[model samples]
Target chain A: MNLAFAEIQETIRMVQMESLDIRTVTMGINLRDCADSDFEKMNTRVFEKITSYAAKLKETAEQVEKEYGIPIINKRISITPIAEILGNATVEQAVELAKTLDRAAKELGVDFIGGYSALVHKGITKGDQTLLDALPEALSTTERVCASISVATTRTGINMDAVRQMGEIIKKASELTKDRNGIACAKLVVFCNPVEDNPFMAGAFHGSGEGEAVINVGVSGPGVVLNALKRHPDADLGQVADVIKKTAFKITRAGELLGRIVAERLEVPFGIMDLSLAPTNAMNDSVAEILEEIGLERVGTHGTIAALALMNDAVKKGGAMASSYVGGLSGAFIPVSEDNGMIRGIMDDALTLSKLEAMTCVCSVGLDMIALTGEVSAATLSAMIADEAAIGMINKKTTAVRVIPVPGKKEGEMVEFGGLLGRAPVMGVNPFSSDRFVSRGGRIPAPLQSLIN
Target chain B: MSQKRAVVSVIGKDQVGIIAKVTTILADNHINVLDISQTILQDFFTMMMLVDVSELEDLEELQTAFDKVSNELGLKINIQLEEIFQSMHRV
Candidate 1:
């Protein structure tokens, strides 16, 4: 490939100045064969399988990084959902399994290990119920383990019972980790129409249909898009979309190459690339900044949703043009704590929880990394999940809730999670209770969009 | 076939011996320069070199040599494998 010098300079500038990097290269390891009647035996098998499969993950990723000069920020592992392996397990046993997964992650030197999860969109099985009951203990006791529960799907609709249960779980998780500013809640996510091949946490899992092992890459480059937009400040909205699409294509192509290299070295199958504009706390590298680049005075203002819709759609279009197999929640992520612009928007009173919810209608992830008041009732939290699930279920998009209820913290207080998780200001929540609505336990039927099949 | 190539980029204030010093390091390592271009963007000099590194066995050694030159010249020098550029910019 005889790439032009200008193109080479542009790619270098994107990396050196614009924070373009491979956000994650998550290896999906299927642990279905590790299940056994004895939990101890199963744990041993799980450890052996993971350590053997990912033994060279960190080293290979570093080698590739040094060779290509591309920063691969995270090396992670996503296993098959633990609930599938823990059939009829007690809550104590489930927590022990979560610890095993955590130990494997620590030993392998990966950042995070996902798949402490249960799918209850249709209904909760025995294994799903046990995992749900033990989510608080599991999350609080582990450092690197992430837990997700899919409470709604396009076909099965919303499971209000699971949604209601999740609210209590989130509260308990926050309370258990209260000393750490309710950080355990950051590891748990409530999802609607969750994808199986997502490389990003806290919602990634190996999925039932995946092979024995696969490698998925998540690409992040919001700063590149913002810089491109700044170069053409006078361009109209249509031209703005064109710029975003081109930038996203480049980002996706780089991500696909990285994923292929990692997978080839590990001798694993190459999985999909997630083209999400995942933001870090770093200045200028934020999805919210990209929104502001589109001429919005603030990220949560009146025209924010329309701006986000254009950006998200253009990103998908561009990524599709570059890669043959693009999957996961591939769009702009608006996680409040992880985005400096979003945090500033909230601090300036320009962004609020309700406005964030409205913005999620056009974005990829929903209510991500948001902090809420401790006094927010479990019923209200459940109602928030239900509303987000309704949006995902009706619109046929992936949406999730990773809201943290910082215990003993009121509005205007900040919850510092440190590092890439970042710090979040505790935003005010609606005081009115939704106890009666959530108490009516049943599934919300799928909408008309689900009838396309 | 796409030959294995590397791109050596240098950027800093326009000064003497920027290209000479970088190309010398490349030449000593048995790496062949395929294409070279430089432009001064209002006193900030930028040069990009596409070099074939098929003969170079140890990548780290070349990197260390470049690092030394970067320190001596006080310029930001980066050597990236060409696949990164090709993949990012080409279909």
Candidate 2:
């Protein structure tokens, strides 16, 4: 046999017991050529383009899952930002385009379709403004469409105007879907320095720089990492880091193999593999659990940031070694709702918004999947975006805020978002107002770090 | 066509005619067994077989056949592509 018996058993154990699986195999289809002056014509082109490219996506993924005996959780499609294809189109047309995307997603049998998005990190164009205005209605009416907006980047300072508008848009989206515990807001993400080829949602989008179409895979295995750490209960921190690196290398190699096969079958170019430790609501499958295993009393305690920083760096090192192309927020994710350990930390009062914000400075994403009180003002939400954007801008990293302000829900109350989104307790925000700060709506002026060139 | 292979592993308690039952199914499907290794660890029967699946038409069909035998013998039988193990364990 080419492989050792122990290695085969270990692989089986990871799949059967440790919840190891490829998170997503997202196909990025460029819709730039789908733009047309006529509203109906553009929508028709958009629908046809997406459906034709993604017709075999789910079937191919299912075949690979069976052949390899490794589950590929989500087979999704991301396209060119709709705002780019909505040249001079009306807000109603933008909403119509979103409906076309949603209809195509349903026809293709995929769960979620991302890239109902706009990039206005520098300034909002007419088309971008149209997409922003249509977000609430677009999100409310659609089932599988996910939206993302980039309001800041390192080179371009924060667009306070877009941030404030997104705050209002999020509130309205929640109000529109208040019957479902504000579920529409869960499908939306506000990003600072968002990546173009991210295979994760609700932030995945086929960026402008990408080619016609490509396949990107996101690998997840927090449970595998946790199990590896449990074997060495008494190992020092350095040894602990080495264990995580080795485990991550194996996970990334498996992901690359699966991704390359999928891309080859689909006849699309293989883009990148995202080695993200994305956690799930399942027990022991959490980045927070990994942190706790690293000698922390809980995930959001005093030493949480240091533990996350070390783990994040080690994961990157291992993944970079395993694959030549590693991109798309390749670090540990700490979404409160999606992670059982994070939810427990929040319930136990060990984790708070402040700690999550602080931890994002050392991790991949920022302030993800947190539900806040209904009374939380839009200015406060904008202020939160500003804070997270500042962290990303200063550190030259990707940060995002996907907060749901559930209508009629108070602090300490819980909102259930069902599958994947899970449930989140409504957290209390600072009572102090950012009304004046956000009201002075202009550019925040790119920091001195932007002048590095 | 180039050669393609897979690893079929069966793990459970040692049972009568376990090897015969599995190899019969492989031979029925025209899958040639290239290598076989079997052991008993702590009163559990574990077997690993490398087979040339290049002549096999559908992997799922063979899996369903194995599923029936697996249920009859009360063993966990899984067949996976050789590439998965090679990619993870090597380099």
Candidate topping DockQ: 2
lDDT tens per residue, model 2, A184-209: 99889999999999999999999999
lDDT of 1: 0.91
Give the runs in model 1 whose Cα sits over 4 Å from its true position. A450-453
Per-candidate clashes come to 0, 0
lDDT of 1 at A140: 95
What does candidate 1's lDDT look like per residue over B38-61, in tens digits?
899989999988889886653677
Q: Judged by DockQ cut-offs, is candidate 2 incorrect, acceptable, medium or high? A: high
> What DockQ results for candidate 2?
0.80
Candidate 1, pairs of clashing residues: none
DockQ of each: 0.65, 0.80
Give the runs in model 2 whose Cα sits over 4 Å from its true position.
A450-453
